[model samples]
Target: MSKHPKPNALIWLILSVVVIALDQWSKAWVLRDLPEYTAIPVIEGFWNWYRTYNTGAAFSFLSDAGGWQIWFFTGLAVGISGLLTFWLSRAARGDWRQALPYSLVVGGALGNVIDRLMHGHVIDFIQWHWRDHYWPAFNLADSAIVAGAVGIALFGLFDGKRSKKA
Candidate 1:
């Protein structure tokens, strides 16, 4: 390991904090402002502010599993976050491309885990639709996780090519 890590690692950490804060804050605001399963239009047909509580994983999978999934998911999130934190601590500080995605994942995981622990379910508020079809409602933490996944994928693809050329 280098004696000094990359400066951008700090930036990644800051970004992770911001993501977690914003995710939790937005969820808090929604809980205070909206009723359960209520939709408030944000962009007419394209988007809306809708509140929902998901007790299961994506798309409400295992949501009706008689409540055992709450602890299971919570445990998974805690484990994943711990592993990510360890990776982040060992990562080169300047390697923002590598660190940022993991940071985002860690932050997002914690954000949702907080909700699960506090409310028995994760709050989701953003909704999108097209014609008669609708996408499942999700929150900022979910967005961050998806974005982080994309970032990591892109970095793996492009960064490897660039490094080999250099």
Candidate 2:
């Protein structure tokens, strides 16, 4: 009897490529058009196209640790992306839940990685704020990473509950 091989979610990697493209393109635009350390108002009191740079992990963690944090973060992102790619290979073709989040993480991680390698810092442009408080500046890659992390956490929680009920 002839048997065909089962499909895998590796195809979802296309999303990763798309994410990387968009993230890079946006950063390029910011570099070319946006002024550094200045807020170009987008919502009068809420948002702006504020260009900035980060050399460390989320929320500028370790951003002031001299210079070694750059390579450390780059290696960390690459390692995590590699691990996610491996997981995607093992995921079932129908498992969008697993593939999607993993793909997002890879895309986001690699996108920022490109920045770190080329510019020695990740370029950030989008900014949100109120009258007195402001969220840290971030980029599309950061958004994707946050979304993916949320998906992984939420879906994993649901999965755990499902298995428990079963």
Candidate 3:
């Protein structure tokens, strides 16, 4: 039998909860304070608080799927979150390289899932645009997920070499 030291799963769980709370709270605040398709400039030419709902996947793919996409995305989020939680449990302490990313992903997935379950779609608000082109609206959770994914990828690339030498 192999004795593996479990990571500080509690920390990950707490962080995940905090992420979910912040994500939900911000969405709720936006829903209450902002109107659909309305933009409130936050940084002039850089960003704005714009309310929009996504019924599809990233970049609004399949957004016009006639509503079936709502359930599909919801289910996908839930599934991903579940898998992340399981992964977190198996992670070893001091393995922030892996656990941190999993935690972030879990948080983001749950955040969007809550929106889908409650609003029948995901509420997005943050907007970025250049002089002419506008980027897709997103929320904090999406940012966290992207950051975590990048961390994981970078760490994997660098850590692989170190592990090979050990």
Candidate 4:
């Protein structure tokens, strides 16, 4: 009988823990130190540390849906995180390309879920602007989610091409 090395990427979950810790810590700092709705310029004419809250998804989508969105979004994030975690458990230890993105997304999703369950909304602070036009405020969790998503898409595309070539 030949022995097999079942090295799974569960170790990558450490990155998820780090992301959650940072996201929660920054949100706590924002709540303690920042003034709500006031923009404090971090980079003159470009970025600001703006405290805000969102009850909905990105860009405040369905934020005013009469409080039901809290459960909706919370459930959705939890489900997605669970799915990604399952994927991580199946991924190979050497497959950082898949493991990394899954970990990031799981961390980001759970981070926001914590806020939703505790405060009924997600805390946001980082803000970007172009002259007078400003972008919707978001937090580190959102950043991780976006980065992970982009990595998944871009890397998956490249991997597909490589697979076809081989």
Candidate 5:
């Protein structure tokens, strides 16, 4: 069988860069135009702009660990991003099913790492709520990460089934 052309991982890196740029830009905008802990209603009862900071992992897991969580999370994200980059480089170039999700994950990880370096925390500005209950605030990086994860899961399921049939 003829060999498939090598995947060009650079395209995925470019996508990662775009994600990082958008993530940082949105965070900057929130920082400049919004106040901390204050919620501004964007919808009747579903969404709001609530500027906040997360110094730890999701749901502030280690936020109260006395500042060590900052470096820990930063290091963790950097390490993960590096590994994902390496994985992307080895992935088949024509398989966007693999590249896009990996790139997004790398971008989102790096975006939050930058926040840890620059501000000691991740800036979150988007909130979803109903009545008196509210979800944790999140930012673009978080959104990208979630989207990428979902993509990866969906792709994995479909690809696995396809391979079984082959």
Candidate 6:
């Protein structure tokens, strides 16, 4: 058998690029038109486009840390994306379960990194809520990251079962 992985292994990179493009484009639209912190409801009491910024990690962790979190999160995203890229390169080409999740994560990380570098914060606009309860604002990059993480977890569960049957 040939030593090289199948071309499909690299196909996931295209999806990653698309995610990055969509994320940046959507953020650009929001930045240009939306007034910061103003909510425009798409679904009454449920969803809204609320432009905001996060200077720290998920859920604004360390957001109030006196501005140092920018570089910290930037560096963290860079490091994580690099590691995921390396992992992707080494993963089996035919294994979509592995390759796709890693690609999603890498795309999401780089997407947010672009925002951090250019705006000094991650632009967030999508908001979901119920009555007084609200989830933190997030964007396309955050969605992809969460989905990818969940996919990886589900893969682990199924893969473990398959391995035991072998």
Which lDDT tens digits does candidate 1 get at residues 69-149? 999999998898787777777777877787989888888888899899999999999999987799999999998888888
What TM-score does structure 5 among the candidates reach?
A: 0.93
Per-residue lDDT of model 4, residues 1-166, tens digit only? 9988698999999999999999999999999999999999999999999999999999999999999999999999999998998888899988999999989999999999999999999999999999989999999999999999999999999999999999
**Candidate 1, after superposition: displacement of residue 166 in Å?**
5.2
Compared with the true structure, all predictions reach lDDT values of: 0.86, 0.94, 0.85, 0.95, 0.89, 0.90
Which one wins on lDDT? 4
Instruction: Report residue 162 deviation for candidate 3 (angstroms).
Output: 2.0
Error in Å for residue 2 of model 3:
13
* Cα error of candidate 5 at position 112, Å: 0.4
**Per-residue lDDT of 11-32 in model 5, one digit per residue for the tens?**
7789889999999999989989
TM-scores for every candidate against the unseen true structure: 0.89, 0.97, 0.91, 0.97, 0.93, 0.93
What is the per-residue lDDT of model 6 for residues 25-144, given as tens digits with 9 covering 90 to 100? 999999899999999999999999999999988999999999889998889888988887777777777899988888888889889999989988999999999999999999999998
Off by over 4 Å in 2: none
Show model 1 residue runs off by greater than 4 Å: 1-11, 164-166
Better of 3 and 5 by lDDT: 5
lDDT of 1 at 65: 93
Error of 6 at 161 (Å): 2.0
Q: How accurate is candidate 3 locally (lDDT)?
A: 0.85
Query: 1 or 4, which is superior by TM-score?
Result: 4
